[model samples]
Target: MTQATPQAPAFQLHDEPGHLIRRAQQIAVSKFHEVHGRHVTPIQYAILRTLYESPGVDQVTLAQLIALDTSSTADIATRLEAKGWILREVLPRRQRRLSLTPAGEAILQGMRSGIEQMYLGMMDSLDGTEQREFMRLLRKFVHLNDQQNKPVDTPTKG
Candidate 1:
């Protein structure tokens, strides 16, 4: 009789950090949908929120600030423009800058309450101390790995 080959250990998907993070993102997004509906998408909200905070920024800079690819930023901007929520103006050098329309401002203002509740809902599983620690650790995790989102060409020498 031929000897059977040994099998490798089983992989654990549920205990993985990437899987957990992805699931967390899904939960947050689902909550966002439940609260905000089809009025805006998560990326659209990111674009809108960034525009609200930093008005009159060019597309490339906006993309960098939001950690999105340039094309995605442009596409989101177009979608927002289509919805009449944002206005695009060409400056002296023909550079397009984005600004939220009054309608956009109003919409963003309306979203704030739901957004707050969404945050609370997502964090409900954690106690106050755990919530604070989670926020701290999450921020640290982002801060530590933010370079992963940056251009490969931007990596500095060791």
Candidate 2:
């Protein structure tokens, strides 16, 4: 009788969905910086756009909306305020209401063309149909995992 040898499992880091998603994010950020320059980061752009649409939202709400932790959101808000791009108002309960300033609006307006170009560039390899399908699937995947990714709400100290 001949002895049988066991084969190694077929596992590849590049083939992992999580790894691919992270790489895609890196490419997106790189493309964003290429178009928008270093003046603002992708996260900051998100915060600015969110505030533009829903102005005067409290810090906690902003954090939830942007899928960020409160501490990070507060830090970003402070940076935006220092840059004169956003205004932060401290509420009675120590919560801060955030809103964009004229400078922030101007920044968004200037980046509009670049934003479109960057998105197009990112998806240039795919056809229109493929792009749409990719986006649809991406949205579905994110939505399905939304609950799992949400930040835990910490109890407030009175």
Candidate 3:
């Protein structure tokens, strides 16, 4: 005889968002690991993509764009530099910039197709319009979250 499945609690957005986010993150990370055949963190992918898209972006800009602290970005950059995937050049006259070596470029290009395919396959349920709407709402959510994390200064009445 088959065992009965347990029932879940009623749907509640506040109660479910965190669980949903964690599950999605786990699934995405698993899929990425399967595709890459190694343990590549999500931040590394972000750094690689950012460098690939905008060559010669300085570490400061990279940190800001990626929403990482300076020290963490520095550590990541150092590791990537050591791996020979990236190079950091010091410019005495100008801001030091980071650029991906040919190896980095090739790796990113190689992974680009797979990444695109992964996203397309995952979002296959959503049509073009739905996908666009989803992206829009996601961006809105991110912006709101950023705002929420900012310090709020209350007005003082004299």
Which model scores highest in lDDT?
Answer: 2
In order of appearance, the predictions have TM-scores of 0.86, 0.87, 0.77
Please rank every candidate by TM-score, starting with the best: 2, 1, 3
lDDT of 3 at 1: 100
- lDDT per residue as tens, model 3, 1-158: 99989987798764797888788788888778777767456788889999988899998889888889878998998988888889999877655699999987877888888798778877788999999998898788777887446889999999
Candidate 3 residue 127 C-alpha distance from true site, Å: 3.0
Residue 3 of model 1, lDDT score: 96
The window of 10 residues in a row where model 3 has the poorest summed lDDT is 33-42
For residues 14-98, what per-residue lDDT tens digits would candidate 1 score against the true structure? Answer: 8778999999898889999999997799888888899999999888899988888888898889989999999998877767899
lDDT of 2: 0.93
Q: Which stretches of candidate 2 lie over 4 Å from their true place?
A: 1-9, 148-158
- The ten-residue window of minimal lDDT in model 2 covers 143-152
lDDT of 2 by residue, 5-89 (tens): 9875587889889999999999999999999899999999999999999999999999989888889999999999999999999
| Model 1 ranges with Cα > 4 A deviation | 1-11, 92-94, 148-158
lDDT for model 3 comes to 0.84
In model 3, which runs have C-alpha deviations exceeding 4 angstroms? Answer: 1-15, 91-96, 147-158
Who is ahead in lDDT, 1 or 3? 1
